[model samples]
Target: DVILKCDAYDGFTSNNSDENDNVGNPSLQYDIGINKCWKAVGPAHKQRYLEYTDEHISVKDDPIKTSVKGNNTSNAPKVEQTNNNHPSIVAGKQLSQIQTSLFQSLPFARYLNLITSLGQPLGHHSQTRRFRPGL
Candidate 1:
C-alpha cells in the first residue's frame, strides 16, 4: 500500500479558489483501486530465475533493419525505369489526395483539447512524464 500527496487545486483550472486549504476536503480524496501481487524470495533465487529466463529467450535483431529492404539500391533503377507505368502514378496521386482530405477534415480545436486532456505536453516541453508508483 502507498499514499500520495498532491496539490489541492487543479493545475489546469483558472478558478480563484482557496488552494492551500485541503484539510477534510471531499474533492481531495481520490482513490484508485489497484490489485497488486507480492512475492517472497531470496536474492540468490531471484538472480537464478532471471538468468534461466534470459538464457532461454533468443536475442531480438534491430527492428528497423528487419522491416526495411536491404537491396534498396538494386531495386531503385528498376523502379525508376518503370516510371511511365500509369497505374503506379495514379495510385500514388490518389493516396496523396486522400491523406490531404483526411487531415483537412479533422477539427484543430478538438485535436488540441484531446491532446491536452490526455496530459500530453505542448510546445517545447518534454513529451514524456516520469511515471511514479502512485501517480
Candidate 2:
C-alpha cells in the first residue's frame, strides 16, 4: 500500500479583480492524496505482485488472480477545509470551541512566504544589497 500526497496552487492571475491588474496570490490551494490500506500482507501473501526470474509462472498459472474481486482502489478522504480554522478531530468526535485550539493544525499561510525572494531563506534580497555592477 502506498500513500501519495501533493499540493498545488490553482489561481493567481493578473485578470483577477483582486490582483489590481497584477499577478496576485493564489486563490485556491489543495492537498490531495490516497491513503494506504491498514491491512498488512506479509512476504508470503499469495495475491501480492511478485517479480520472477528464469522460467517464471505464466499468466494462467499465477496464484491469487481469481481471488481478487470488486474495485481494488481505495477511497481518499475529502479535502479538509483550512479556511475553517479548526483543529483536526477524530472521526465521529466533536470538540468544544475552547478545546479545539489545543490540537495542532496545518499552516496554510506559510505558502504566502514563497511568493517573494525576500521572504525566502536563501538571502537573495540580502545579496542584492551588496551588488557592485561597476566593479
For each candidate, what TM-score against the reference? 0.23, 0.14
Relative to the true structure, how large is the alpha-carbon lDDT of every model?
A: 0.24, 0.23
Instruction: Give model 2 RMSD, 1 decimal.
Output: 24.0
Q: In candidate 1, how many Å is residue 107 off?
A: 2.7
- Give the clashing residue pairs of candidate 2, or none: none
Candidate 1 local lDDT, 20-114, one digit each (tens): 55333233211111001101112422321100011111112311111112333331111111222233233334444544554444464357568
Off by over 4 Å in 1: 1-76, 81-85, 108-135
Best by TM-score: 1
| Alpha carbon lDDT at 5, candidate 2 | 11
Clashes of 2: 0
> Which residue pairs clash in candidate 1?
none
